[model samples]
Target chain A: MNSASEAQYREQPAKRLRNAAIRRTGSSAFMTLLGKECLELLRSFKLVWVPIVFVVLGIMQPLLSYFMPVLIEKAGNMPEGTVIEMPPPVGSQVLADTLSQFGLMGLLILALAFMGIVSGERNSGASALVLVKPVSHTSYLLSKWVSMMILTWGSLLLGYAAAWYYTWLLIDFVDVGPFMLSYVLFGLWFTFVLTATLLFSTFLRSAAGAAFSSLGVAVLLSMLAGLMPKYMGWSPGALSGLAYQAVTSEVLLPLNSVSWWSIATAVIGIAVLLMGSVVLLKRAPAHD
Target chain B: MTELLQVKGLTKSFGSVHAVKSIDFSIQEGRCVALLGPNGAGKTTTIRMLTGLLAPTSGEVRFHSLARGEDHRSLIGYLPQTPAFHNGMSGMEYVVYSGRLCGLSASDARKRAMELLERVGLASAAKRRVGGYSGGMKQRLGLAQALVHHPKLLVMDEPVSALDPLGRREVLRLLQELKSETTVLFSTHVLHDAEELCDDVVIIRDGEVALQGSLAAIRNEHRRPVIELKLEDAPHAINWAQSFLQKSRTDELRYSWLSEAELQGNRLYMTASHMDVARQGLMEELTEHKVPFSRLEVGYSSLEDLFMKVVSG
Candidate 1:
């Protein structure tokens, strides 16, 4: 018993030294891992295809909105003299419509793409190989998170810029300030969904399961917020709705108490989810 | 030599299923050790725990050179049974990436990766995607990645078990060369592979250590005289062989030298304590009983025989 206690006492300093070493090299390892993740994304053509898909989704909204009356007139079987009356679409409203398209199809694509970010490596046992090195679990998880954020933000920026360009060419001009503000809101909502997906991926073994469960939770939250605006006004789910309102109002500063509440909630939710994922990753850095 | 590492009562349990029971062993520096076990005997589980891939339910693996509780992984180079890599990355990229993860600078990682790839005979295929690598190439690439940091202890799980004979020979030869340079702890079910490369052997059965010692010591301790008689294919010879076992069981003084005897078909096999006395007694009995025997041979028991007995019993 005395020897056992002495052994434990001797271990404390070594444990501290080991942790110091991990901390010292942790950032470099994270950068290397982040580079690898980005490289993988590029090699797999996900970086190109995902942004392209977002761009197509973004462009389709303004194109379809601009030509909706004509499409209706052409598709509807009416008399030769039949004329459809439709209001000229507002530029901000069309941008909001683009955000809605992103809210649906764009979020789905991001969720699916990010679903396998961690689970795929864990499943393929590739993560096991890396984790066995002197790499820290926090570094591994954070690297994935950072690279994912880069992809999500980059794709969203590019796709929204395309939408803004097309909206200006075909429709009325939108205020850049309000348009960018709404873009942040939309990005936050997408961030929430992606964060949830990442958390699920780190904990769950199946990539498909991670994707579906996260999507399911996002859908549920959005529906709940939509159903009860007064009660669920501060929920992260309200970010999408706030984004639409911010764009449609054409207000340069759309910072209401409710909007601030929702943004804070979303930001907090993202932090908590990221922290949870890091914890999960540390506990089971590799699952065979 | 000094001790390199020690495994103290390491155990693992997955809910109700115990994968590895309490196991204890130590490895000395610069020695090659084999964790010999059959399939499902927890060899992989033990290796995982030792390499810090899997958490042990109880007990610990301690590296002697460092104080306890240090991250010994920096000193350990691990290769899984069926190593999986990012199939999209080239062999060179993967090794360099591994080196970087182990805290090497980009330039150093590249240089080391180049050196190791050439050493593993993978320099020619370095630019090829790992997905295109054959089994032997992948195994060699696995070795390169594991060695990127020039680890003090190299751990491998069933390193050559999944390979064809040609691939197996290639890896075995590599391991033979590597064992001289670093402390190696590898698991294998093949006794011949263990005997060929390892200085120490730890045989496990059902997640428990059956026996463990230096190979020379185990060989010397378990060696015993064995005799075999190929009898004529006749009713009289077969009957005599059958009664021999029963007689040895009952008659103590005359057959005391015979520790065990068994007859299969017309052949008789026996293990004896004293080879000369047992041979003399058998020859006299055969002549007196007029037992028609074709041949008689004497030899010593091998590690294979001991392994079979320990695993089966």
Candidate 2:
């Protein structure tokens, strides 16, 4: 036989072996579950719509802020000899305004968007489909966690960049150097909170229940912080507040030890909530 | 035959009430078993336990000879009575996602999804959002999701209850085609569905098996044959027939009035029992009394008859 024919013979066996492996692997089960989740997320106009709205808001907020002074100057409606003194448009101020108004709200909205990720499936009998797959409860929860994390991080980064560009346009000299490291730190904090909220959502049966529960926790903590000065250092709400302050060039106080401790506690809290949701799901009756 | 699903002494209770009570059964490969029961007979609970959705209060459920060993819970496929999916998704997207949940790769899931959708007759609606689907179409879509991964065992809870007559026939036909390759255990309150589709029937009552066996065996065990007479007037004919039947006093024959319907100017009716006894008794009565009837028909007991007997017994 020629060398080409020998090569063909070798390739044929390899191809057959690959087919056999695919059959044995049950890869179809995993794909089916992933496809279902992605499709469900895609179909959820609330989830898809909220992010698009936030991104649009993110882009618009910075551009609007950049042009407001220009528009005011062009109007020339001030009284004669009256000087309208305006503060220079700094990158930090733009970042702070955009992050607080759009970025923070966006993260909160994203968190609320996933409040039904696991619970909705539970209510809709989709969990029955998921459990029967070759996937484990841990992997199921992890998949949602990973997907939400990436989406939240991506949205925040996009907002951050949009605001920076708009600020640069408004002010000829834009300095993003000082706030860059702090923005990254703040993004991590937002991601952590987002993960915690999602974990809470999984534990409840309805989207409303999950959203109320997460928001209730945050609101209660904030109330406690206001009522008692000492409570502010340990509240998870400080993460967003601190990040906002850092970006705005406010007096940067060293995070109290309690704040650091709260971050650790938040991490553990998220893990526990996620694992608890998985266990609850395993025990919940199949909605047949 | 290999036992594909082994459920033994499985039980579940909600506080004071027992939803499923020590249910024991096994499903063999290549067999279609119909779980017959009235409302609240624990059929749903049994399915929940089998699918690992609820932990049994006390009992065992084991899947034998799975491709991935004993822990292969993913090899089973389940269809709920009201299979509520994310309504925002297209049919194709829903089926593919169901495949992925079962461990299929992305490309493979998409490929199999098309084939399953076509099998369930939802190919044209593949790209349409599920929110707009009719009830039958939704049920068909649910079935497509259940079969996307080519599961070894498919457990359906009242799979055809929500369908219209035409849709029911279509789903039943699809299920019949599937029986050649996969094991099917479906629960239904509709006995005709069981009679027309099932090879074996397991009648459950009050959270227990009232009767279970092959369709023929169940009919033979619980059903007694009877005769039906139709007349122009139901009230007058029934009154005359009842009086005549009482006077004839044939101890060897037994029968009862089944149902009656008014059609045009004539009354259509039926009754049921042993064919020979019914025939002889009817002939003697009709000949001696000179009773005139529009039509006389003899029919065998159906699964409905057997089911009523078992559930009522």
- TM-score for all predictions? 0.94, 0.76
The prediction achieving the highest lDDT against the true structure is: 1
- How much is B256 displaced in model 1, in angstroms? 2.7
lDDT of each: 0.90, 0.71
DockQ (Cα-based) for each candidate:
0.71, 0.41
Please write out the lDDT profile of model 1 over residues B1-313, one tens digit for every residue.
Answer: 9999899999999999999999999999999999998899999999999988888999999988887787888999999888889999999999999998888889999999999999889999999999999988988999999999999999999999999999999899999999989999999999999999999999999989999999999999999899999999999989888888889888988899999888887779999999889889888999999999899999999999999988777
Question: Which sections of candidate 2 miss by over 4 Å?
Answer: A1-94, A171-178, A226-229, A248-256, A285-288, B66-69, B105-111, B225-302
Q: Which stretches of candidate 1 lie over 4 Å from their true place?
A: A1-21, A253-258, B250-254
lDDT tens digits by residue: candidate 1, A1-288: 999999999989987997776776788788899999899889989889999998998899899989999899889688899878999988888888888888888888888888898999888888889999998777788888888888898899999999999999999788888888888888888888899999999989988899999999989989999999999989999988888887888468648798789899999999999899988887777776
Q: What is the TM-score of chain B alone in each candidate?
A: 0.96, 0.77
Among the numbered candidates, top TM-score falls to 1
